[model samples]
Target: MNIPKWILDVFYSYLTSELIYFDGEYPIATPVATFFNPTKNSIILSTSVSFYNKVKCIKQNPNVSILYSKHEYSGLSEKPVVLVHGSAKVHEKDFEKNNAYLSKLIEEQKETWKKEVYIKMGRELDSFIGRRLMDWYMLRILIEIIPDGIVCWKKEANILGSVDDLSKTIGSVKGDAVFAFMGEKYPIGIPVKLRKSNRKFLIENPTLNLKEGQKACLLIHSHNKYVKEITLTRYKGRISRISKTSRISRISTREGEIGEIEFIPTSKFSFKQGGILNSIRFILDGKRRAKKFLERYKKT
Candidate 1:
């Protein structure tokens, strides 16, 4: 893996990255704190055993992609967004060994992460109360991703149809979005134009060969420079191609077909919504969920 210096810098310092993997068929995307293991030259991420769905997905299909596209307050200049196509290995059997490595990896980022969490929710993650409440998160599993290839670009090419001037769009969502579609070897994610159509969403010029009735995912999220305020929403939906004839009159007439993929969301999940009360509620709810997951883990 001959990754460039700039890309490694981003991977080493990035606060969070979006992890996309195949869940049997459709892509599932989630945000995760990433770490670089120089010894093994692998990307490392730890999650609670409670997140069985993600672990199960990796076991079912190891092909995955990690995208580092956000650059708000990381003390770094604007850099090309890096997308890593990789194969994943989940470390689950040896609880003690995995936990020790996770503990050290976590300690390295504890100050930075704790500072951000403190600013966002006025809570200390290492505090006594926090420790007691988040024990489930401490019962961890490690995900090691070995990169097969890397793609870096500042932004998506503006070859797709333009929706900048369209007055009436479809969905009611406004945030940075990462579009996921099946690639030759694995699911790939890229920054794309997101707009509304009817009650669903539309992505402009999906570049990849897509068909009608195919399943995909849209990750919509927003965050302030301070990192105190954030909101993320994930949509799992099926694709329907909007042909050239159905293209709106305002759409540009270029060489390629004026193509668009309509995303009809069949399910939705809001992982984070920033606010003092909301954060408190989320923490409390997480504690309960963690307890249940721990019980579930022990049983298995």
Candidate 2:
């Protein structure tokens, strides 16, 4: 499908997108830095070599979906929420070449990079320390997603809040959440209404394609209206039919049953905020993690 220019513009300016890839059992979504590489005619994203799960999944199942939600610090809240389904090509053949490509990409978006650094670290983009302490982030493996389909939600302006809410262990059930599962070739991602009770959550019927035992993932995230605070959380689990009848309406364009499903999340991750000590710990942990990855890279 030919991507509209407006969607391409969102790809360029959007701060972060939820990159959803299928694991062997279920779909998993993670927040990733994105770049619209015009030359490649694809969306380029880099993941740390230490993050083995994401890289491994892309290699196993090339089908992926990227949600460019304007609710985050993307600064384009007025624009429609866009979802892109694409086939991914992992570019880890040459680490140095990948690193250089990412460096140039970052340089082109220097101001945006600085703003994100300030927001996340409460500091300026200090190159010396960054080069020394953040080498793990630089030791990257790139993934390019060639667009196959693009869809948009034009009127989702109310989806903004502090990441603190959705980042909690028991997140706020309000706001928009994306549910993803395998489609024919590309994984399908669509926003669904979220409801929680105890540990298990409920979402209105999203699609008829979902099976009882199929693996799926739900991503709940938003930012404040001012675009300062952001929250992102993901839950991965298998699907089961809900026993009770549901009053929720169907949301997907695909023909499906109008009943609910029980989403028993086996695992979850919340992108939350921390204090100064936590930030220090985060960098130290990254350094330690980088050592292992770098050591393995050398052996290879």
Candidate 3:
């Protein structure tokens, strides 16, 4: 495949740059070791770190923007630059699938180079370790960078002369603006409510401090849009039914009174200053209480 020279240059420059930032936040950037052609129009660039955290950020807030430019190189007219802005998500399965294709590409390159070495050596040596080495080498993982949008600037002028000029020279010259063929520039959030369509269960108490393995009844308040009634229970199992149609009728512990509890999906809830273990405890306890209540009703 023919790779654009401008893209190659930009990738090279970015590799040596100090850092990439977003809204004063420093995002981790690693080298794109191998590129995988997953589909006819898509390519995945491998990175050093797992993008799970980044995907979480995008899911939580989709509004994201990025700018790339060379500050040190000012002599070149029409400085090479690009900006990209788009939403991102983590797809574990897709990433793994694409990485497999990239492995094949890496092997092809290695084999081509090995042939040249074999020709120079004039003979093949013992091949005992060949299979094992190849297996170990191909086990490396790769990250996939799926580009949403891109902007680019050309460096040189075309046959159109001044009209096609990208630089400051004898390029495309329009009426008021002297159009020099300038190098190509490739430039390139929101919270969504978790509803039943995305996932079931309403999280009413998002800020309560619950210990790991503790029991609590998740009371769903139907009247209030945001307020969910959570009841702390001492039992541990499954919630068959949760209602927010009326005020919560059960009270459990000092955390708060259980007014009708609403259920929210765990994926939609964000922890302000606590771990997920506590959240899981709250959910499990609520489920357990609901199961016990159902059992008592059946017995009665």
Q: Which candidate number would show the highest TM-score if scored against the true structure?
A: 1
- Spell out the clash pairs found in candidate 1: 170-196, 170-197, 171-196
lDDT of 1 by residue, 223-266 (tens): 65544466889888888765543243346534444456688998
Residue 131, model 3: Cα distance from true site in angstroms: 15
| Residue-level lDDT tens digits of model 3 in 100-122 | 55545434332232223323322
lDDT of each: 0.69, 0.66, 0.29
Backbone clashes in model 3: 58
> Where in model 2 is the C-alpha error above 4 Å?
72-77, 93-96, 106-126, 155-175, 206-208, 222-232, 242-259
Model 1: lDDT to the true structure: 0.69
Weakest ten-residue segment in model 3 by summed lDDT? 173-182
Give the Cα RMSD of candidate 2. 7.8
Which runs of model 3 end up more than 4 angstroms from their true locations? 1-39, 47-51, 61-79, 86-89, 94-98, 105-148, 153-300
Q: Please estimate how well model 3 matches the true structure, expressed as its whole-model Cα lDDT.
A: 0.29
Question: Which stretch of 10 consecutive residues in model 2 shows the poorest summed lDDT?
Answer: 163-172
Off by over 4 Å in 1: 94-99, 106-123, 155-175, 224-228, 243-254, 257-259, 274-277
Candidate 2 TM-score to native: 0.76
